[model samples]
Target chain A: MSHSYEHPRPALAVDCVVFGLDENGLQVLLVERGVAPFKGRTALPGGFVRLDETLEEAARRELEEETGLGAKVFLEQLYTFGDLHRDPRERVVSVAYYALVKLSDHRVRAATDASAAAWFRLGDKPQLPFDHEQILRVAKARLQAKVRYQPLGFELLPPRFTLAQLQSLYEAVLEKPVDKRNFRKKILSMELLEETGEREEGVSHRAARLYRFDRKRYVALEKAGVNFEL
Target chain B: MSHSYEHPRPALAVDCVVFGLDENGLQVLLVERGVAPFKGRTALPGGFVRLDETLEEAARRELEEETGLGAKVFLEQLYTFGDLHRDPRERVVSVAYYALVKLSDHRVRAATDASAAAWFRLGDKPQLPFDHEQILRVAKARLQAKVRYQPLGFELLPPRFTLAQLQSLYEAVLEKPVDKRNFRKKILSMELLEETGEREEGVSHRAARLYRFDRKRYVALEKAGVNFEL
Candidate 1:
């Protein structure tokens, strides 16, 4: 038996830009490709989409298969790249996605089709294969703009974090120094964070009080048309 | 000659959600389909992708072919839809794009493959075919969110427009009433609009002053880290 369609078809694939934050600053995950066409070259973790799954599922599966990362994170569809010569093998269309994960939670480990996996600081990073570099740049721009209007930046922080840690996350993503007093006053007025009734466990200086993001309150406030700006 | 590959591929297509603004309010361009799958049903102007053209080119071509609208407009890729059951005949993946045009500039007329073409109020649209309703909803949400931060609403208005016209564009897209004095004060403070030194013509009442969007100034201000928030 055979199936026939006259026109040529472009192969579809999914690529992910996974971002994580730590004391060092914002970072992106890259995997060393273990197969041709760009074998041994560092690139985003992704692969051709299977016949049975949605684009989001394909992104999640590819991220875990190449980098040993978990599927639980803040994931979003960023953009689709369909440049004629983007892939060397054939005409391929890639649906790109961006994911945010807490650095302290997911340890980096290479697996399956990746020779090595590691996090690279946003500014200082290895040369990428194909169009992964462009995709990463787009994701960074989106993160920078979105962080100013949405609360997704909290996804990069720990469950219990100090106000200083939260402010640092914003600074790292936005690449700008926010006024300490103004930042504190604005975020606190939104009332999206709750006192965790605890302090930083281990630090060289006096520990500061920790707080947790109030997801329920945030959802209610968002429904009531509250704009979250920092 | 024939090419052989063993894997199944989804048929690729492009759909456009073309938005225009007028005295009636925000409107979308819809065409009465002349072919099947949904024969005679009203849907967005679009068609399958050709092997030679890029996704954007395909979108522009389809828009012009289905409706007699010109190819000059502000076009942007919205999202990709690939539900397995979206097309009854076969698996299809659609790359959706949204375009903004001035209603007065483009007098729409049905052409080659459409039975009829017309602009319908966004809220009072006819029943659409093949998941197009969902695509339009996404486009509307994107437009509403984007209008608050960007100067895209100008694309919907005439080149020289009055402050009242600009405010109405925002109100129609946002589906909410904006305070007249506040809207003018905020928009004027940005200094992105330049006075044209002319007034609207052929009106029974006093003519209002007209202004032009300063694209060059907006670009410079954006590069200098100016935020265009309303």
Candidate 2:
């Protein structure tokens, strides 16, 4: 079967900005291109959208194909980049998505048309090809703005984490130092977290109590008209 | 000059969800289609994208071509809809945009392929063609969720509006009543509005003081780390 149209169409593609947090700082997933146009240059994992898949499916497929990592995580549509000269070869429109993954869940490996895959600190990343640099900037700004009002910081940390760890995650994303006492008081008052009855293990310093995000309670409170702002 | 690609591409289009506020309530602009595949049906003003124009440009152009109302308004990309069977004739990917316009500024007029253009109360709008109803629903939800945290309510009001009118606009979009004293105190404390030293004219009731949205002050406050929450 074939499809025809009178007007010219621009090729659609999907790009993914995978963010993870670790002991160092906030990091972004990058893949080195193995194809020409920007051969051997680092860029976000993405590819042309196939006729069969949705934009999000295309994004996830490209992400897995380029970087050997797949796990259920927080993913959402970030923005659509469609400048006339965004693609040097042709008129291509890219629907970009941003994903947050727990660093410990999925190990990264390069495959397909990607020579290497690695996580680099967001601010100290290498130059990217195409319009990826701008897309990354937009995604970073969105993450910073949204983390304050939403419970997305939990996506980057382990399931059971200390308040210090959560605060560090917030500081990493927001690029600011948060008052620990105020942060703890505010977050605890929200009642979106549950004490895990455990403490951080394998640390030299004083162990902090661990807590898990209460997804069910959060959903209930959210439905009951509660705003989670930090 | 010509371009060729092996894979079939979906035809791209741009749709606009123009919102306005009046004495009745929140309203959305709809145009009657004059072509096939939902001809004569009410739909949001939109058309196919041109090669040279950006997605926003296409949306703005379509808004002008279908309904002759084009003043500077708050326009933002809402989402990109790409369901396989959204359009009956073919697979068409539409970039949806939501715009806020002052009803007093733009007088709706039908033009081009539009047989009629009118503003219908959002809750009482007619059945729209294609996935326009879904698009409108998404736009409405976004407007409601965004208005509380951002100062977007001012976009739907006149430049110099009374506090009562402002509260009404908020109540209309939020679909809920706000406490008068609480609303007034919170809004005034933000210092984002300036008293214009004018009063409403030609009304049956007593005149109310008029205030203008101080965009400059809002920007400064925003940069100085102030949160605008209702």
**For each of the candidates, what fraction of the native contacts does it recover?**
0.24, 0.32
Ten-residue region with minimum lDDT total, candidate 1 chain B: B106-115
lDDT tens digits by residue: candidate 2, B1-230: 44446888877899999999889999998988878789889899899888888888888888877877674778999998877788998777888999998888765343232448888898798889899999999999999989987999888888999999999999999889999999999999999999999999999999999999999999998899898989
lDDT of 2 at B113: 29
Best by TM-score: 1
Q: List runs of model 2 lying over 4 Å from the truth.
A: A1-4, A107-115, B1-4, B108-114
- TM agreement with the true structure for every prediction: 0.94, 0.92
TM-score of 1: 0.94
Interface RMSD of each: 2.7, 3.4
Model 2 complex DockQ against the native: 0.43
Q: Please provide, for model 1 over B1-230, each residue's C-alpha lDDT reduced to its tens digit, 9 standing for 90 to 100.
A: 44445676677899999999999999998988888889889999888876667889889998877766677888999999877778778778889999999888765343233448788898798888899999999999999989998999999998999999999999999989999999999999999999999999999999999999999999999999898988
RMSD of 2: 2.7
